[model samples]
Target: MRGRGHRAGRAARKRRQKQESVVQSVSLCHELQYVRLMKFLHQRGFTSTLLQPALFTDTGRGLQAVKSIKPGQLLISLPESCLLTTSTVLDSYLGHYIKSWKPRPSPLLALCVFLVCERHLGEASDWFPYIDVLPAAYTCPAYFTDDVVAVLPSGARRRASEQREAVRELHSLNQNFFRSLQPLLSQPVDEVLTCEALRWAWCSVNTRSVFMSHPSNDSLSGQDVYALAPFLDLLNHRPDVQVKASFNDVTRCYEIRSVSGTLRYQQAFINYGSHDTQRLMLEYGFVAPCNPNSVVYVDADLLCDVLRGDRSLDQKIKFLKENNFLHNLTVSSEGAGWRLMTALRLLSLPQTLYHLWKAVLLGQVLCEEREEWSVQTAKTLCQRLLQDSHTALDKITNLLRQCDQPVREQLDVVESLRQEERCILGSCLELLEGPPRQPDELLSCAPDVDAVS
Candidate 1:
């Protein structure tokens, strides 16, 4: 009995030891991947010692400052040889075969095909190190399942639907193109150009590419509109930080300089222009909390609904469409933009005064007492927005409450977006409901009619 008990304890110890070895092997493999990627970048002229990758609980993988980086200092400089541009695809090993194919692929499409080809080549591909690190999936709303997309706010849902359609079209195109190339290549077309693979490549280009004009002497005309920069693409986005990125011809390098200094161990960020949350989420698959550029889109259909009872509604809609003032009605932190206000004013106008309102918008005339009507129209619009926003918020809140466990992160994103909309709507309501001012006082506070037009 004593010997049997000792044998059981020995078996447990061996199992524990084996498990530890497996864990260490996996950790070592990840470290090796990191090292290989870094080594590849170094060989390609990324010699900056100040920046290194670090994992963060909130942001996943991002570049961290290994030492204090000063303002105006060059952080990264990749020579033209390293950029993955249209020219690179055209000059690649696969390009020779694709040249004879009828109906030439656009630069963007060519890049997607190039990525697919390289991926199939596996370890033999020159870009294997870079391709290995590409994200396996994206969180962009366009990739969401239909059921998940249906619950989004109306404007977001519409945008997501549009994006999904675009992807579907691209997949069809890729399928046909790949079929034609199958006989010319060793690998099967279906293996290289699956819908999922095409989407991964397309999004990799969409999310990480930068725009730059090609060298003047190159055969490509105009500009190389999109080029994928390997290491440079790892820098995450922040709306507040300003970065100066440009290709320096003299230096023959794509250089990035920081306008805002970063302290040691701090994450460095770049501004991808002043994009609203919806645009960011659609393209980048991430949202910045408290983004200054966030805006809530108020659909033009809502305004049409508001003016449904107005007898002149059809005429107003006609006038708006003719004058090209019919779209992009939105509300932001600063309140509604002039386009929304103008649409509302046009809807509120009587049929007899449609031509006169057109003249006003064209800056042909100014009415002295127009403030009262404008103010009233703005208040009505604000009230309608508030009601709609509250209803959407309540629906989202109820959905969240019904979940028995923690909701998915995507749902959390939807809730955050709706909350922002509600907050902005409340602000608009507060401003519209403030004590009424005399017509002349309100007109004095308003922007110049010509400038607004």
Candidate 2:
């Protein structure tokens, strides 16, 4: 019996040893993967690893002269202090969660990779934060892609492999960022409502800025958090996008409108390219996703000019398009019809069909208003579809419209916009067929920018 007990103890010891070995092997593999990811991030101008301080910090006098460098240059130099703050914060968070990181692989690396594996090239920037502006957010410098290739040792035979791997890493990082936010989006509204710290929840994803509706309790409603989309973000945009949470009497669902869509379209025309943009306009009809009726409009003179071999703006426009840059070129005093249409259509929204109606109504009214104003002013109005205060005002107007309260109640909320001293109404009156019924109607309906002042 004693001999039998001894044999059983030996068998148990052997099994335990085998399990430990497997664990060790798995841990080593994970560590190696983590190291490789870190190196790639460092090479791409992401994190300056404390492990390899020499890789990022600049030493030579030439480096000192160029105090401020472009993102492409920074990646090449691997400067430590110049890196984004988020990286350090994340590093600390990971360290606390992952003890004995020495030989252990970082779990975050796997999480990042899993999330970003499906991301497009445009999304690489956000995932790898080390890369310059996201392709979706802003045009990354054309040279940055080149700089990444240059980082590999000269005549490296595996250049393609290196690039592919780097791209994969970037994608993973982006996916992780979104994944982190997913929980917040998925949580029950009541649970999310428990925390009412935010005065507003402005989500700028893709090209659309989705503003959440706050109830009297100032908590997020049941609206699903919108994720950023690639094609949608590439569309032309302006700051005046907003929504009012009021149910449309015509249709039961919530309604949204582009308060400044008219001005946006007006400005869009002024900035519309006189050359290729004109051609693109004619070839591709303006598709207003908001306007279901598709009120067709185009500039004949502009089309005629493009057809006559006016390709002056082609090269410039092609370059901007390649770099993801936005420019302004007004085709006529009235506005660029195709440009306005494309801008409206390319804005793919995830909102319900009801919201689309509100969008269409907003577009028609704004377009009509802009056409009249531009004709009277004999001036083109345009801006590089940037998200700024002007856009915020437009968003505010739409939100007020969506409120469940009466128009007067809505007006009270939007009174601040009306208080603006611009001559928005005066400009619209000039385009109107006749004088407005009353000055207030002109302000409320047509709206003069100056009356608010």
Candidate 1 structure quality by residue, lDDT tens digits, 13-66: 121111232211011114665677777877877776877766543444667787
Residue-by-residue lDDT tens digits, candidate 2, 1-453: 000001011111121111222211011112443355445555644432111211111100000111222222211222333222223323433333223223332332322222222122223424433221222211111111232222211222133245334434444433433344333343532333211111001101211222223222111112322222111111232122332223233532222232323221121101112222112211111111121111112222332232233233343334335533332322222234444332222121112222332443344333335334433322222221111225545554555466433332223212222222112323322433354223122211333332111
User: Distance (Å) between predicted and true CA of 239, model 2?
Assistant: 12
Model 1, runs deviating above 4 Å: 1-30, 183-187, 215-223, 358-409, 437-453
How does each model score on TM-score?
0.81, 0.18
> Which prediction has the highest lDDT against the true structure?
1
